[model samples]
Target: MDTSIFTDKTIVPEDQDLIRELKETSVLWYAIRNHVHGLYPDAMDEWHYSGVKYGWSFRIKDKKRVIVYLLPREGFFKTAFVFGQKATDVVMESTIAPSIKELLKSAKVYAEGRGIRIDILDSSLVDDVKQLIEVKLKN
Candidate 1:
């Protein structure tokens, strides 16, 4: 089965479509978006279709710098972030989560930064994402 609900390249997902697929987690999705906008009023969000393998993803950017990518799944969503050396160090020293820290430790380093994608399954995980966002913006 496809991981994302919106896989059709010809079509774009609307707010109602997201609500139907995300269900309870839709609250988290909106919360995160609102949080980012609250932090960076000028943040711009756009949806992109990354072929069939990746499907559709919502990307948030603060001016030219990307803040995060929200990947919608069946009942939940994921948040992808790329942190530079400084931001990676901050995350390593943060109280985010051991698994996440481990993910960071093992994440392949790209020219951009160390990429880590986390599943925002519940409210507790949302806090971790928020912390990561703060680290990303600050560093």
Candidate 2:
């Protein structure tokens, strides 16, 4: 079986260096995939963001709605989730990790919702990220 990522742009697929970059992150990405895909098997989509400087957004979509945005980093990845007032209350009430709660507390509030970004270094944080996903899906 051939496991490779084909980019949205022909320009991207043609670049061997870009393919290698994707390959380098494959292990970590697979760790992420194991957790996310287990819960949201159908949420997978080729929803790559355009002109990303650092890495890509691995979005889990439910029809037209976006559940979460997983941004890949050098040796880690960041999960972006937006929570409304009610969801914020839920997060505050939940027994998530202190660091994650601190992140929630400091997250910038916008008109739409409070945007929370969490960086995950290893598979250990997958459960927390999933909880955040539950918060995102709640609303």
Give the top-scoring candidate (lDDT). Answer: 1
What 10-residue stretch in candidate 1 is worst by lDDT?
1-10
Kindly list the per-residue Cα lDDT of model 1 for residues 1-139, writing each as its tens digit.
5467789999899999999999999999999999898888889999999999878999999877889999999989999999999999999999998999999999999999999889877787888888888898899
How far in Å is the alpha carbon of 121 misplaced in model 1? 1.6
- How far in Å is the alpha carbon of 20 misplaced in model 2? 5.8
Candidate 1 positional error at 73, Å: 0.4
Error of 1 at 18 (Å): 0.7
Cα shift from native, residue 89, model 1 (Å): 0.6
How many clashes in candidate 2? 0
lDDT of 1: 0.90
Prediction RMSDs, each to the true structure: 1.3, 6.1
Error of 2 at 4 (Å): 18
Candidates' C-alpha lDDT? 0.90, 0.64
